[model samples]
Target: MVLPSVLNADFGDLGGELQRLTDAGARALHLDVMDGHFVPNLTFGMPIVEGLRRHTDLPLDVHLMISDPLRYAGPMVDAGADMLTFHVEAVDDPAAAAQSIADLGVAVGVAINPDASMDQLEPCLDHVDMVLIMSVQAGFGGQAFNPIALERLRSLRNQYPDLLLEADGGIKASNIADVRAAGCDCFVVGSAILKSDDYGKAIDELNDQIASANPSGANISPGQEATR
Candidate 1:
């Protein structure tokens, strides 16, 4: 699935930008929620999330770049977040945070920084609905996609074949195919789409690249792994 990160979108015309993406056939919207304490940057809060909910019916993939996710789970869910992804390093107990989000009836995901190992998320893997491999450091957008993420994607795919794997950061038409090949099914594109004058066209280009790359592999789905 293609999820356009709103971090690079025109904040003043967010509704319009979201509508354009929806019109282009995006299934979900990616929101980067950064608190000053987690990373160097600070971004939107729960209020913005609540406000955005009114403008779009698409599922919100909320990535909390904060130090505390358990504290914000309720507010985020109340703000209409369909999925909540928290950093593995942020919480003392990843499994608990995953359960906490799941308990709130929202899809839970675990995100690992580029330098972090996939092993850090093993305990929560079974509980999460997805795993996001950050291609770059958190807190910033438009940075170059780090090649290290490809190996992480490969490892995750090899270990949990059916898990919903997503890639975020510096994704563009040039590297999207390679990313998908490495095992990312969901592409979280930001500046590439938001910075372009033609949002729909940009999305179309990304899809086209992914289609041409034709990622080939097999892995167990999350459901199958759980049963195993």
Candidate 2:
């Protein structure tokens, strides 16, 4: 699925970016909420998320890179987040945090930084609707993709065959195929699309590529080695 990362969007012209993504058939909007304490970079809060809620009808996939996700889960959900995803390393109780988000009647997701392992999220897998594998460090955007994170996503795809496997960070047309082959059904692309001169065209191209690779929209089975 196409999910445009809002972090790279033109904040000064937020509505324009949202409209561009929506017009280009983006399935969801990825909101990256970062707290300086957890990731060394501060980002938008509930007000922005709430304001964006009125801009588009696409599902708001909010990614929380903060210390205490539980504290903001309720407010985010109330502010119009359709799916809430938080870092596995941030929360004191990952499973509990996932449950709390799930209880808000929104889909719950758990994210793992490039250095985190699949085993770190094993206990909370069933409670989450999607598993986000960050292909770069959490704080900033436009960084190079970390190859190791691809393996982590491959592993999660093997263990939870039916769960949504999302990959974020350095996602562009160049690496979309490889990520898809690695079993990522959802993608959070930032600078790749937003920074392009033709934002709408970029999104259309990515969607076409994804569709061509998975015409049936079936999740490709992970490699045998990944299952272990």
Q: How close is candidate 1 to the true structure, as a TM-score?
A: 0.93
Question: What lDDT tens digits, residue by residue, belong to model 2 across residues 30-122?
Answer: 999998999999989899999999877777889999998999999998999888889999876888888888788888889998777667898
Runs with alpha carbons beyond 4 Å of true place in candidate 1: 215-228
lDDT, model 1: 0.86
* Best-fitting candidate, scored by TM-score: 1
Error of 1 at 171 (Å): 0.4
**Model 2, CA-based lDDT:** 0.83
> Which digits, one per residue and each the tens of the lDDT, describe model 1 over residues 110-149?
9999887777898998899899999999989989999999
Provide backbone clash counts, one per model: 4, 0
